[model samples]
Target: MSPVLQIALALGSVVGLMGFMAGVRHLAGTWQIGSEVQRKLVHIGTGIYALTLPWLFPDRWPVYLLVGLTLIVMLLLRLPNSRLGATLHSVERQSYGDFLLAISVGVCLFLAGDQLYLYVLPIAVLTLADAAAALAGSTYGTKFFRVEEGEKSLEGSAVFFTVTLLISVICLMLMTSFAPPNIIVLSLMVAGFGTLVEAASWRGFDNLFLPVGLLIFLSAHGTSTLGELVFLAAIFALSIVAFKIVAPKFGLNAHAVRVYVTSIFLLLAVTDPQNTIFPILVLVAHIWRRSVAPCDSKFPDLDVVAALVLVSLGFLTLGKATGPTAISFYGIAAMGMLMGFCAIAASASRPVVRYPMVLALALALFAIREGVVRLNPDSANWNGPMWPAVFICVALTALGPMILSRVFATHRVVKLTFLALLIPLPYYVISTGF
Candidate 1:
């Protein structure tokens, strides 16, 4: 089919799906079905439709166009007065899952290209595994554990793992030529990784992370030995324990720690382990400084953990896509810059020393990055733009707090998150120079 015709069909199908889900939502209310179930119905339906992309539309542009249109419609539906908001927003939780879901579809499609299974597997995990976990948690959840700002059940997580494992097995079996033993090991790894991501995720961000993280993990580790898989899993387990034990000292909450540890582990998966050091140090420094700053009753301090996850994932994608050692440096620098901003924001009361502290922290992070590279025998050659990138990141980061403070003194999470989205702009410019 022609691209134009494909785009037209996609739009029609998406619109029809939206109308169908709206009707479903109405019937759900009539039947006294809970809002969460209603929302999951839409999620599952959307994800299942997404799975057909490789066959339905052969070209990437059509999928991109569909994603763009869907996002705009989803945003409009989110408005308080929109009648269709109930189809998705019926849950009381503050979530941007719908928005992220649209973006995840577009991103995974763009990345996967002709790799049908690559696209299918991640979307399957996101859709089926996530819905299963939520439903299981809400319905059969007996044993609960605290996560971020809420509680998740052990029962729910187990269900999630089971569902993910099954999905991974089926996908690998049909999609690739790997032996049964390797398939089982890869399936186990995928399930474990997906379950951790789902459990750690809050407010629908899992819609983005589950698919994106799984795609990256599978792409990087599809040929791994059982021993290698076990070793990585052991390190991941240790990281979680370490984060849980140390988060309190750094003034990081359970949620922040979850985001940080998961993101770092993802970084570790694709990049040299040494490349992750500065980012880890930045995570520690950012949270520790925020912890020490005076508390305010009127406005709660901003939680930059989600922002950290966003920035890290952005750079990871950049590094992976471009295949440049300098890209890794940029990731470290971007994170270091974020650490600087956290310092300035945490010291909002003491404005006098904020800039100096930010400068010092940025320099310290640069020094640490250099030190790590020097110590690693296997370090890739340093790029020329790296130091300049670090300087530019720090300068831009310092300006961010000032700009936000001028508009509003209180640090709202959304405001900082939007700011974090801009953190990569400098590196994008610098990479052009390189």
Candidate 2:
């Protein structure tokens, strides 16, 4: 059969299995498995099973049919639960208008596919990493690590990074293996950077940002045909594995220090490929010091710095791909600076704006600018001129607060300034077709 058909079949079978599992659980008298253990088992199992489906069947009809049946069953099961019932009922009552916007966006993304990888990476990060962090934090977290915006445990961040990194590495390796050797390193850099963006993200917006950001990055970097598909499969498998391993480890407070230490080593390896020896040394030292080191204080800020650096590298890699366009280069630099400032400000203040909100605003601004550029008529390429608009925005956003602080002598104005920065988003989206 055709490749598309095979993908369809695989996806279909997976959806069918999920629907079956839900049915079986509902039928079994032991359905009240209310613990995190049970919930995680179901999620992990379903995710793994789903991830393998595309590879197994590779047929579209079966996949679509299976997905349809699964949705139907889910609706049927939720019908009896009052909360779910109410939500579904509300959804049914809503006008098509509510969905039109979302549908349009989806269509646009589908059409843009490779062209929008950079814009989509942030969304993917939000979805996968944020979800992992919340699950890990709520379940296994003991000692709380405070950031400028809020508190997350070292354990939570570790879980988040582990999941993001593993998924990224596997996908990137697969993609790179089939691409030209020159571009392979660039792909790896993109994945590593994308993971960092996810790690630093807050709230649930990482969900949206991660995928969108990755999409944008991939689009800019370009991907080989078979390699891209294989890479996608790797992401699915890695996500499942991360969820399964980390979910169960949540209760192991005794191992938190070990886990954190190991995570730091892995993160270091990701950020600096040349210093492979350093992570080994760090790992040995951490293991040796495990018993003596205090676990009660907080996760080191070094990990955060590493993540930021990776993101910067990814942007730089993309900039390199597009040649030295003054606007594009500067735009990327500006955005990176803005993100760094936001992160710093969030870390410093209590009751500061949430990290996810800040990331969303940044992403939305970047996307709007890109979309606007793509709409330009004079460019031979459909994609807009490689202007440094995003970088410029980032710089202005980041520095606006510092400038205001130095001049107006008040940080309160920083919020307003950031808020004002959002004005360009709606106009850009509406005019640019998404």
Candidate 3:
């Protein structure tokens, strides 16, 4: 059979299972197993079905096919009169979790090559671990923390971290023959990051970020040093403590701490902390974005100098830098900080500002490109070949949220900006060094 046909058949079976789930819901006497559980049932199926795609097709064509089909089905299901649409319409109604699941699959396939460990790890954890977290938190969760997109349960997040740790350790150990001494630490780091991404995910955004985040961490496996692990651990610990003492309103609860920690860990895992500007900027941007309100301060209340000092100290103790590296670091940090301020400023702005904001982003990218070329002429690694790709990515990172903001009013431009930054900027930065 053709690979595409084989994939179609396999997907048909999965849909049949969904139909069975629909039957189970009906026979259980509710005709609806409730919207959230309905979502979970689908989420659980995706975990299983995702495992089959990479194994069955062994190429990206089927993976993209799956993404396209899922997106089409998801949109069709949203039609007001369709039965399946009515069924799923209220399942995390505002978000595109299923669509992101397919995107994650496509991304992993593209980046992972033949590394089944990398491809399967994210899909399995995202599918099963996330489903487990949701079920545990929703059923038994009592303690809640305010997350940017939604409220998360401590119990649920713990469940997510534990499951992700187990999956990463067992799977990666099998893949690389357990070479790294800090495998346990790596597991903890992945789990912590998984929890962090989950906590930050709003309106089903976890579906998109979680797999992508997992792929980034997995790429660094067996290549990270013991000291790097420790440095990442300390960064998270101190940052969470500082956030608690200094900006508790930044959502420095246990769940939020895990998110912040995971981010720093990913950066350390993927690239040098000395050029740590981008990661710090991304983390701070999210915190700053969350800490603001439309009726509140016009200027940010954040202590920028303190954040600068903490990351700078961490980098200095563990990293080596040259003049060019310093310039690149500060340049990226300045652009990111400005983006964050733009997000904060957007909270109260009128609808007419998006075009000018996009135009400003274009001009900023142009100037940043010229400045980077002048100051970092010796930065040939990225500047030589990947410069245009990097420039496009940075521009997309800055402009994406402003464009998306017109569509999603429930989330501020800043909230959208968090995903925008988290997704693309890290990729550009990591590609430069790793």
Candidate 4:
């Protein structure tokens, strides 16, 4: 077959499937089906199609071509003149969730190479788990917590975690050579991360946060013994049960307790048992100080727990990264904490980074102190190359965004998140002299 013809044929098939979904959406709406119900159908159908990407295209270029084209089309569909624009675009205003969703698939394709599981894991979870969470929540949701304008329920989150857990396990087992125990831990960790990212995400930004994050962090860390794996799984299960048992007392957001336990389990998986205290201690303080039920207020402080998850991830990353690479982890971790502050500050409709800069500086200082204590406590190597640069970069990156956020004035969380991810690239480049 001619290469051009094959490419044309492949692209047509993708567009055709999308057209079919659009037709279904329209027909369903005309038949008096709810818009939200039709939306979920499109969501699941699109997701099921996404799973076929690794198999549908023989190479990465085709994946890129299809995804890029889809993204452009989706963007155009949001314009005022488009036929279905009114139905497709949310009535509220401009929503970038669909845009981010396509971009995430492109990113997973670009970076995944032969690691199909890595690409598939995030997409599948977002598709199935997220859809399930939404469907179950909307239908059965009773106890409420706030996200943009809607309230997410405990029941829906449980559905998300269950589905995500199943998907993660299947992805790991099918794609990797890992044993049962490692698969269990890895799946639990990935599911936990997805839940938090999904919970914290607003305006469909979870698409970006969940997949991009898993792409970076969700590798199968091997477990040495079945006994150790069993013990690890036991702790994870107990933590969930404990939270469910106790969360009612505080009207806690399930996302918080869910992510906190995941952090501890992941930290235990990656880091030495000794260094676990810093992250755990921080979690304890967060929980201990919450005297009121999280749901007492019309709005809950979602950022604090979500930000800690990112920081905990940074700490865990350090255990895996080495030498020059390890040095980059500090800056990444600092930004993780800073990103948290930005999330919180954005919720209050404030110019967050202006004040988040203080948190950034404090975290930088803590990083420095931890570095001093951990690396060279015997000697006063206060003049190290990495810590100094990390401090400067952390401050500059955290505050620099304040100006940009002020100017942009909307979607600061999304903007700050990408900025935070970018801040570490230079450190990696400089470290490798790339």
Most TM-score-accurate candidate: 1
Over 305-423, each residue of candidate 2 has an lDDT whose tens digit, in order, gives 22333333333333334443222332333344345345335433343454455556567656755653455334222334434444555655555554444432333223423332343
**Cα distance off (Å), candidate 1, residue 324:** 6.4
What tens-digit string does per-residue lDDT give for candidate 1 at 135-246?
9999999988776457898888999999999999999999988788888988988898888888888778899889989988887887787788778778888988998998
Off by over 4 Å in 3: 1-32, 148-150, 248-434
Minimal lDDT window, size 10, model 1: 293-302
lDDT of 3 by residue, 1-434 (tens): 58768687657854765585566456434663677877777777766877887666655675676677767777676677666554455654466676667666776666677777878888889888999999999999999987543677999999999999999888878876655567888888788867777876655657766876778776765466878877866776687677667646554555445545555555565555444444465456546555543323221222232243233323322222222233343334345444644544454456577557645755765565465455444652343434454455455545555565454344343443343345334543464463
Order of the predicted models by TM-score, top scorer first: 1, 3, 4, 2
Give the residue spans of candidate 2 off by over 4 A: 1-39, 57-135, 143-152, 178-208, 222-375, 378-434
- lDDT measured at residue 197 in model 3 versus the true structure, 0 to 100: 78
Best by lDDT: 1
Kindly list the per-residue Cα lDDT of model 4 for residues 1-434, writing each as its tens digit: 45676589668966775686678667866897665666666667777887887776666677677777888778777777775544456435335667777777877666566777878888898899998998898899887676656557878888999999999898888888888867887777677767766775665667766775666656434334566645655666787899878876665665556555555655555444544544454444334323411213232334444454444444333333432334234334444335334333333334454365457545755665465446532222222445555555555544554444453244433444445445455555454454
Q: What is the lDDT of residue 183 in candidate 1?
A: 88
Q: Which TM-score value belongs to model 4?
A: 0.63
Task: Please give each candidate's TM-score.
Answer: 0.86, 0.37, 0.67, 0.63
Model 1, C-alpha of 101: deviation from truth (Å): 1.0
Query: Clash number for every model?
Result: 0, 68, 1, 0
For candidate 2, the clash count comes to 68
Candidate 1: TM-score? 0.86
Model 4 / residue 286 / CA error / Å: 12
Report how far off residue 341 is in candidate 4 (Å).
6.6
